[model samples]
Target: MKKQELIHLHGLLAEVCNHYEELSGATVAHEEYSELGIRPTSIHKSKTDHKAAVFALADGITNEMTEETKEPVSAAAD
Candidate 1:
C-alpha cells in the first residue's frame, strides 16, 4: 500500500481504539504503542514509523479483546 494509504489505515485503527475504549469504558493497554511516540496525525514521520505504530496499536487492541473473549465459537458456518 502507498504511504498515504498506510497513514489512512493508521488513522482508522486509532479511531477503532478510541471507539472501543468509549464503548467498553476500559482503556486499551497501549503501552507499546505509546512508547513508540507516534500518532496518526504525525504525517511528517516515515511510512515505516507509521507501519510500526499501526502494528503496535493493533496488537494492543486485539490483546484487550482477547482477554475479554474467553468463550470459543463454533467454526461451522451457517
Candidate 2:
C-alpha cells in the first residue's frame, strides 16, 4: 500500500481505538460510581485486555506511518 493509504488507515484505526476507549472507560466509571455494586456483567475484563492489544496495534501502525515509534507499556500487575 502507498504511504497515503497507510496514513488513512492509521487515522481510521485511531478513531476506532478512541471510541473503544470511551466505551471501556464508561463501563468502568459506571461500575465505580453506581450503588448497584454489581459485578462485571460480561466478560469485560477479558474483552478489555484485547482492547489494549488492539490499541497498541493501531498505535504501532500510526507510529510507523508517522515515524513516531513510541514504546507503550500495556501490562498490569495484579
Candidate 3:
C-alpha cells in the first residue's frame, strides 16, 4: 500500500482502539506503539515507523479482545 493509504489505515485502527476502550471501559495496552511515538498525524515520520505502529496497535487490540473472550462459540447453526 502507498504511504498515504497506510497512514489512513493506521488512523482507522487508532480510532477502533479508542472506541473499544470507551465502550468496554478498558484500556488497550499498546506500549510498543506508544514507544514508537508515531501518531497517524505524524506525517513527518517514515512509512516504516507508521507501519510498525499499526502492527503494534492492532496486536494490542486483538490481544485484549482475546483475553476477554475465553469461550468459543460453536459454528453450527440451529
Local accuracy by lDDT, each model: 0.95, 0.42, 0.95
Candidate 1: deviation at residue 46, Å?
0.3
Query: Can you write out model 1's per-residue Cα lDDT over 20-51, one digit (the tens) per residue?
Result: 99999989999999999999999999999999
| Candidate 3 lDDT score relative to the true structure | 0.95
> Candidate 2: which stretches are off by over 4 Å?
26-56, 59-78
What are the models' TM-scores? 0.92, 0.35, 0.91
lDDT of 3 by residue, 1-78 (tens): 999999999999999999999999999989999999999999989999999999999999999998888798689997
Tens digit of per-residue lDDT, candidate 2, span 12-74: 654654575576452122222133221223233344443444345555444443443256556
Candidate 3 lDDT trough over 10 residues, lowest sum: 66-75
Off by over 4 Å in 1: none
TM-score for predicted model 1 compared with the true structure:
0.92
lDDT for residue 70 in candidate 3, whole number 0-100: 77
RMSD of 2: 16.4
Give the RMSD in angstroms, all C-alphas superposed, for model 1: 1.1
